[model samples]
Target: MPENPTSQPVPFRGGGFNPRPRALIGLAVMVVLIAVWETGCRTGIIHPLVLPAPSEAATAFMELVDSGLLWTHLGASLSRLVIGWTAGTILGITVGFAIGLFSLARAGMVPLVAAIFPIPKIALLPLFIIWFGIGEGSKVATILFGTFFPTVVATYGGVDNVDRGLIRMGQSFGLSWVSIVRKIILPGALPAILPGFRISAAIAIVLLVAAEMIGAEFGVGAYILMAGSLMAMDQLIAGVAILSTIGLTVSWIIGRAEKALLRWRV
Candidate 1:
């Protein structure tokens, strides 16, 4: 591996924009921010009424754990999130594929989706409550409705963006339409669809919190609402932290899925 000054080879420039992990950097940033926040609160530079210290939030979080309400709230939220997100994603993908592959579906549904996608899904919570009642049904329906439209847009967009040349080559080679779609189109579309999952998951979480705040009893959103009503800023922050943890967990799960399913790119 000696460097030859007289006969130098060209440097390799084919390496794409590969991302490397910087976990420690992110951790350090969070630690520093918390330290500053705690210091400010202790020194009276930051008012407790305005922003609670990180330690106060931690104490509230531990209190929930000690009372065993943490599990109850987390379990309820996770159940709704899973059921709603799974159902919406499956349905969106099915309809998306149809729209992407067919002229009639594309013509009819695209306009409908465009019209509905812009409306804030949270605004329809009252209607859902009226239809499904102020129960688990309403909450799940809220999350499902919020998640469905974005997923449809992302999925169909992904399919549309797939290379037509590859599809034509498949056809010229006498490959079946099903085979072309399964092999070439599906994989090509995954890069977009997976990120769509991320968007839908975030929407689902937001909708879950909004819906639960209405009439739900055993959820992180309900906990946050109660804490806010009682002026318990620390507990409110703790609830927010719990939501952040859920977001992080969902993101990690999606990253793992991408790693497993998109190995061809590696």
Candidate 2:
């Protein structure tokens, strides 16, 4: 049979929505913005007192480095961030797995998570201080609490969303319960869980700042608070830049983790 003359092969339209990595584009955008900001400050389009130049912020950052206080402030924040975020992540994963794997745990914990999740964690800082005192304990507790709920949500949500077909297939193969959970469920849930980690990390930083601003003496938040109180915009911006750097660093770490752990997807 002859093919119809008007019939043309359909153009391929199955391009996957995979993102291409053009990291330079992002870097260029940031550079352009900073250039504009610096030019504005130089030309008086923006006031110095209102917003210090990026150069000024850099100078202040250098001052911190020279004075050796950068490490002091940074070390304190890192310790808290690491401790609190790690603790929260561990517990969240545990609780989330519990909720996902067992019916009784789900019935008991889901409502509890829902009820407590909506409350502002920053608001609880005062209560934490009252309970744990105006020290590292309160600050750590604030970050921990802030991180925990979202992680729990992410963990259980990931688990629930895992393909039951895969689970059934494993069972049909006579895989043990622990083996199924370890090999199938854990990997399936990681995509969700890792991003949840990103969210929890961001929350932990915010809570850390808030917690530090109240009573701590040596953290990025404390540094920013002091700079603001003294009307030192450069130093304030420097402190903020520090926090941003920390966030970027955390994001990069997580990205590396995703690449390492999710190689099977590719």
Candidate 3:
């Protein structure tokens, strides 16, 4: 005899798909790709010198770990990223606020920012090298230059979109310009500036590597360059993979911070 339709237990739908199962599937896909690449390399279908297989990269990673060289390169790269990104974000937010708050500031800075926006920062690499020398200063300056403009533009847009009524309400209370900006303008602009930083963080990291590659004694970028020059394909691939992972991780952290700080936006 068949059971009544209404008598069956309700299936769990709250999980949609189980998180563990979804994670396992993702891992399976990564494993499959790695396996395919490994097979291709072993069979000579893919040139190992040109594109090292996952296994080769894994071996190189272990070698670097054992030699204690990976940490040195990683540290140098991270330090530069921190210094450069901080400078860029601070400058961008300050200028953005000025432009958003005053018509005169907007009229002057907006045109200047717009004019420079189209210029490739890489073109200024030579200038930075000339002024700062091919050292840590130049490297950090290059990254700061690369990340600054986008952040400033995004932040200015955010501030501009803030509701004027709120500003008027604050003014009705006889709040000073500084007080209103601190209490209202910044909070309103937070949402726009958050995404800008997320993008800028990634760009800053990339610029750090690029700067290091051009002129640095130690950095992940320099490691990759040295490996590539020596035909150490596995090491080169490992260095690049590490750099990419770091960039993604930094972006994720910034996004999480943004969500936390902008919780009131909801």
Structural similarity to truth (TM-score) of each candidate:
0.90, 0.92, 0.87
Count the clashes in each prediction: 0, 0, 0
* Top candidate, metric TM-score: 2
The order by descending TM-score is 2, 1, 3
Q: After aligning candidate 3 to the native by TM-score, how far in Å is the CA of 133 from where it should be?
A: 1.5
Give per-residue CA lDDT, model 3, range 152-220, as digits (tens). 898999999988999999999999989899999989888899899888887887788778889788899
For residues 1-266, what per-residue lDDT tens digits would candidate 2 score against the true structure?
27666767889999889999886999999999999999999999999998999999999999999999999999999999999999999999999999999999999999999999999998888899999999899999988898999999999999999999999999999999999999999999999999999999999999889889998889999999999999999999999999999999999999999999988885
* Sequence-dependent TM-score of model 2: 0.92
Residue clash pairs of candidate 1:
none
Q: Which stretches of candidate 1 lie over 4 Å from their true place?
A: 1-21
lDDT of 2: 0.95
lDDT of 1 at 99: 89
Comparing 2 and 3 on TM-score, the stronger one: 2
**Regions of model 3 farther than 4 Å from truth:** 1-31
**What C-alpha lDDT, on a 0 to 100 scale, does residue 54 get in candidate 1?**
95
